[model samples]
Target: MIKPLSMIIFGQDAEQRSLTRMQLISGGKVNVVAESSDYAHGLDLVKRYNPDSALLITNGKSEASLDLAKQLAKEHPSTVIVCTGTNCLTETVIKFFRAGASEFLMQPPSQAEMKEVLEKIVAARATADQNKQGEAVIACYSYRGGSGSTTLSVNLAATLAHTFEKPTTIVDLNLQQGTAPIFLGVKPVYSIADVAHNQDRLDAQLLKSFHTPVSDNLYCLASPLKVEEADDVEPSHIELLLSLLRGQFAYVIVDCQHFIDATTVAALQQADTILLVTLLDMASIYTTKRTLEIFHKMGLGDDKVRIVVNRYVKDPDVPLDKVEQVFGHRIHLMLADDYRAALSALNLGSPLVSSQPKSPLVKQYIELAHKITGREATPKKGWKGGFSFFGK
Candidate 1:
């Protein structure tokens, strides 16, 4: 069950070079049917075909090849890259790896070497697809304070990363009062403050350097501990940051500020779904009402927002119907009361979702995540087709 691999090449001689390269790659059994020649054209091909690998003949001293490789790698992190060039100097080889090349074949490479390189890059593609399938995003936001937004965001991000073998980031955009690092018990050398201060210098490599990895796949960019030491991050800054993050993590969950500031608004717009968390109380309900009204004006519809009743009870002073009636909307999800356990989990820097996946609370979140992703409401149920083997 072998799938045809998509391949792209760099420069004007794309057709001739890529075709010849494809001959070696196909080995007649495997199809190296897809190819692209130049950097701009390669981007279009990669976006359209989603190539498994891009075989680059590194243009003699210029970084045209390296630059193209970096762009493709960022878009399709799983897409392997193989470089063929005489200029495979020590520094240049390091650059290729940094740009996400799986293997580099020097100019006048051997048939055995080419075959070996092709196999390695293709194998990497298979591994990457498997990893991508297992990823999911958990978004943590609140309708009001004291409903435990920070606690939930920190724990939830950690849960996905540590428990599921998925890469996750706990982004603390609370900005002024964010407590993400405090909860995770980590002291990041650079925080969102630095990112804001150095927006012009923000790039893939620098952003990676700023992230404090909480676990193998779990990382965090906590808030600036000092509230005032900041430049007001613009909407563009947030847009660029989140766009970059979509590629880096299986889940990019932010502990969002309750208010719709420039940053929060940007986050909400880009979110796959928004979990509007609240407890069954008057103050929260009132605040939720105001926020929804504001969102309505901005056109963030009901379809995008999921109301989560955190710390809920079967019966409460405020009934679900009455509460919904007040807001003129239905209650979408409910998590049972477990204040002590939630607090303990937050304090210990462990997420209830991971430690207690089957807990009523955890189950509710899992269900919501499934629904948001358009996966089956039933958890084990998967994508429409049965998992593909080789020739789908």
Candidate 2:
């Protein structure tokens, strides 16, 4: 089946706009959403129409055209961009490509060239949609509070997005006292209850509406604002909600409450990796051992259950070797204690990975992301300085 292509034309020349519109229409599969006279207006058109592709005219010495293309590509990576101009110089084509334009056409493009470009865009979109359908789900749980499971969940999701550049989401399943949203500094207008209420009519767009953006690539599905609201969420709702989210995001990190309930059980069953967070304390260790036994009875193996030691130090009340022997499972990940950094992030309503990018905590999360993604984590130049909190 032939897919329809939505396009917006950008050019100052009336004659050029007319020619391009005529050529696009002649292709019989393109729909012109809007026309712009300059790069600024073209950006406004893109924001309004959200077409499948934006056709930019880089005539003369319009360096601003390349800037606009780069901005659109970075901000809206899903949109395809094509550039056309009288200057088909190899240097000009290279610039357009670097600016994120997928295809370039000469002035008054032939019908064959237009058709070929549209087909390429459509085929690429189809393949991307197919590949992004299944997402990895990571669930973080602890038998005791203050084990830092929620903090791990939030930073792990952010690291997966910032480091791996994949679309990631964190779900707060601790309904009553969930702090995932607070950590991200987002007061969501809608919560998971809203999704449960509208489950019958839920779709990708509707599910996404409940997600509040934590960053360009990370989002959060916050817990219920009112504790009582969690009562309305059913275990089946959790299963369905995760299924829907898996289709939309590349990674879904779930922060579960301390106690295991119907909702948490459902989440654990769906998780690709169940992170059991503990501390170097007797209480935390004892609880973790019991939790692992429960997982065993539930038919989960060592591969599925990953033991994480949070707030670990070289010397502790309970030694690492002793803890491992007691649990009978090697710790898969260890996060160093940074009380000052953790306190600042909690107080500032931002994640440590974003707030204290230079903090060693951020590297721990990055390493965890690498472990989960099976990808290598490389440090950037001056990365030791860390990143500013989204320019905060």
Candidate with top lDDT is: 2
Which candidate has the highest TM-score of all?
A: 2
Candidate 1 residue 378 Cα shift, in angstroms, is 13
How many Å off is the CA of 329 in candidate 2? 0.9
How many clashing pairs per prediction, in order? Answer: 1, 0
lDDT minimum window of 10 residues, candidate 2: 379-388
Question: Which residue pairs in model 1 clash with each other?
Answer: 1-390
Quote the positional error of residue 316 for candidate 1 in Å. 5.6
lDDT of 1 by residue, 113-210 (tens): 87777677667767864556545334567867788777667655654555455677888888788778766656678887777776655656677777
lDDT of each: 0.66, 0.80
TM-score of each: 0.61, 0.63
